[model samples]
Target: MTQNKLEKYARLLVKTGINIQKGQTLVINSPIETAEFARMIAEHAYDVGAREVVMRWSDELSTKMKYLHADDEVFDEFPDWAKEFSLSYSRKGAAFLSISASDPELMKDVDPNRMARQQKVASSALKEYRERMMSNKNTWCIASVPTAAWAKKVFPDVSEDEAVERLWDAIFKAIRVDKENPVAAWEEHKRNLKNSMEFLNNHNLKSLQFRNDLGTDLEVELPEGYLFVGGSEFTPKDSEFPETEFIANMPTEEVFSMPKKTGVNGIVYSSKPLNYRGTLIDQFSLTFKNGEVVDYSAEIGYESLKSLIETDEGSRYLGEVALVPYDSPISKSGVLFYNTLYDENASCHLAIGKAYPVCIKGGENMTSEELEQHGVNESITHVDFMFGTKDLQITGVTHDGEEIVIFKDGNFAY
Candidate 1:
């Protein structure tokens, strides 16, 4: 890409994606492999008159090594400064940019359960931080950086540079950078998705269904006036304003919402593997009753998954249940995006971690304790796994036994 093109991408991140206002602090979470792009972001943020640009980088290999060797005590002890930093950031208006594209498989050797538990404990230390991030509401956007591992996953036969090029092309296409007017394209896209949401809201359907050859018979109840949110940008911090980012549209074609915390039932087969805390749970199946996961099986990482479900009372219940038909842009590209930023957007999925306050009616203002009472799952982790398949069919039903087709053959119907 030319410098101008690169600059355009950066500008898009600011003007279009995050829509950074003057004097906003930009916190960018990136990997060292993407330091070049991070620097470009700093420059672009400054160009857009940002107050400050804070960049944090993580070495995936080093983190994995730590997980392999760290003592149990290390898992329980979180740095006070880290907690303070989280709280401080939450108190202010800030913009967050997450650049992934790291090797999702990098943490494969680390114990997933241990890592998951450690994260939960660590976040517990930063309770205020968590609250502020969620309740205060911040503006944030997630993008990715193509690393050697991600590149290798995409193109096993190609060299690293070639793989990176291909990955970049995909990113460009997924974000609509190839469009003559990318921002305009995103605006139109968001408008289209909003129309879908409006339709679902008008239906006022009570429950949603998913059926497929894999025996997915699940029902997710919707609280009254529950909004279907997609294709929008959000504030990462307290003071930052909101802008629409990437239309929140993934390559997948599922319009999703959070089911009533106490309403999910039936069994779901994860058509896609779940990589959590460096562990990949392949061929996973979970059974839910009364909104709690009662049964689960996986070809691999079963122990880790078991640990996840047992984390907290709300862990067994879901926070966000999303549907993505196989027709997603990522799926259409026929790429197994190891990164969840793309992968989660690629397929219909469910999260077992913290519930989005926005997902529940009047949830944004609810106290954590109150939310718990409502059966809203709360955890530091929000891991998503795919459940949508080609033969899957979904029907939305109301309390009166009215049924409306939502998805069929891995695509949205009506």
Candidate 2:
């Protein structure tokens, strides 16, 4: 990829992804491996009127080293400074932008339970930060970067440099970074997604039944007043950042909303491998009863899968259900990026734990207990696993018991 094209891509992210506003502080959470690109983004953020740009550097190797060497006490510790630092950023109205690009097998041998425990502690420390995000009170965006290790995972047959370029090109297309007018294209794309979400919300869908030959025949319930969000967080009612809209995830495709915590049933299989706690969980099927994952099996990462379901009481139930067509750009590319940011956008999926407050009517203002009473889950984690395929179908049942096929053969039906 040429430097000019790369810079243009960076500019697209700064201008259209999070839409950095004048005098706003833009925080970039990225790995040290992508320092150069991160710096480029920082420059572009400033050029777009950002008051300050903060670069938070992290690396998988360091984290893996910690998991391999840190003592048990590290798993339970939640430093006050760590909590305050993030809180300070949110408190200051900083616009956050995180980068994801790590080798899928980075934590191939790490202990899943240990990682879960450590993450739980960290999640607890930043619970308020999460609250701000879920409420859409703070703006944030997540975009992918191309790293040698990540490129190697996506393209095993090519030289590392070639793999990187190929992956970059694919990502550019997926995010519309290569559009003749990227900003305008994204505006149109976001409008289309919003229109889709509007249709779902207006349908008053009570439940969704999914079926596939992979033994997936699950039914998920959606509470009244549920909302679907995708592409951007700018609902008609949102008055935040009116000048520049908020895009939560770059390359976002799925129109997602909260599923009633106790309203899911049946068995469903995962369509793609999920990289969790540094472990790759693939070929998994979960059985649900009353919205809780009662049983699960995986070709690999059984322990990791267990850690996820058993993380907390809320973890056992469904939190978010998302719909993405089988023929989405990311899906048709025929590459498994092995990263959730890309993979989840390629297919239909669901998240366990921590429902977004934006997904329910007045959810953004409700307390955890209040949300729970409405069947919206509350937990410290949210993990998404894909399950869309060529033969997958989803049917929506209205409150009046009228049944309508929402998805047929993995494509949305009008």
Candidate 3:
């Protein structure tokens, strides 16, 4: 991609992705492979009057090496300084931007148990930071730029350079950065998503029934006062910038909400591969009873899937339910990025683990006990897996006992 195009992409992330405010601290978490793009984002942020910019760089290969060679006990502990690093910035009202571009199978050979242990430890230590983000206490966004390994994974048949170029093209188009006015394009896209959010919120939906030829036959109940959120999200009234509005995920096409902690039942099958912590889990099916995963099986990465479900007590339960049309832009591209940040936007999906508190009415201020009373699931981890397909159908049950077709043949009905 040309430098001009790259700069444009970076500008969109700063101006619209997190909507950086003047004199506000900005924090960026990025992969080392995308250092140039990350630097571009930082420069753009500073140009927009940011008070300070903090860059946290990570390397997937190094992470994998640690998981493989580090002492087993190392995975069981999270450093206090690491926890403080995130907390200090978040508490000081930092707007976070994360670049997501990792090789999907980088950790395929590592022990799933080691990764699982480390995940649990980190989640526990950073619970406060995680909660803040989930409630929009901090304005944050997750976007992506193509990395050589990721690009090659997405287009293995092509040369590395060609693959990277192809991935960049796909990313630009998906995020609308290829448009003449990318920011304006997003504004229009937001308006379109708002329509769906309004439709779902207007109906007092009690539950949703999902079915498809993939053998998915599931009924998921919505928690009381649950809200379908899409497009831009606003920081809570008590947040550092109460009026700040940000898009949490770039190229997002799903309207999502929390599911009742103990109200999901039946079976659902995966429609696409899930890239979890550099591992790919594919061709999986989950059996839910009372919102908990009673049984699951995967043809690939079974151990990794097992580790994910067993992460914590709450990991066995469903926390979020999201809807994405099969006809969406990312879906139309016909490219499976194998990255959740992109793949989840291409399909109707559900998360296993913690629910977003902001998805419930007045949830941002709710106490843990109060949130539990509202049937919100809580956990250290949240993982989304795709299950949407062209043949899928969804029906919503209203409080008045009326059955309404929310989705027909993988797209919104009405």
Which numbered prediction scores highest in TM-score against the true structure?
3
lDDT of 3 by residue, 153-207 (tens): 9999999999999999999999998898999999999999999999999999999
**Each model's Cα RMSD:** 2.5, 1.6, 0.7
TM-score of each predicted structure versus truth: 0.92, 0.97, 0.99
What is the TM-score (0 to 1) of candidate 2?
0.97
Candidates ranked, most accurate by lDDT first: 3, 2, 1
Q: Give the higher-TM-score candidate: 1 or 3.
A: 3
In candidate 2, where is summed lDDT lowest over 10 consecutive residues? 234-243
lDDT (tens digit, per residue) of candidate 1 on 272-353:
7776666677888889888888899989889888878887766788878776657777778877766677778778888886
**Candidate 2, 1-414: lDDT as tens digits:** 778778978998898887888998888999998999999999999987999998888988989998889997888898898788788988777888999888888898888877889878998889899888778777888899899998998899999999999999999889887878888988888888888898888889999999998889999999878998888775233424543568888888889999998899999999999988667999999999988889999998888888998998888988899999998889999989999999999999999888898899988878888888999988899999999998889999999999988898889987
By TM-score, rank the candidates, best first: 3, 2, 1
Which candidate tops lDDT? 3
Predict model 2's lDDT versus the native. 0.88
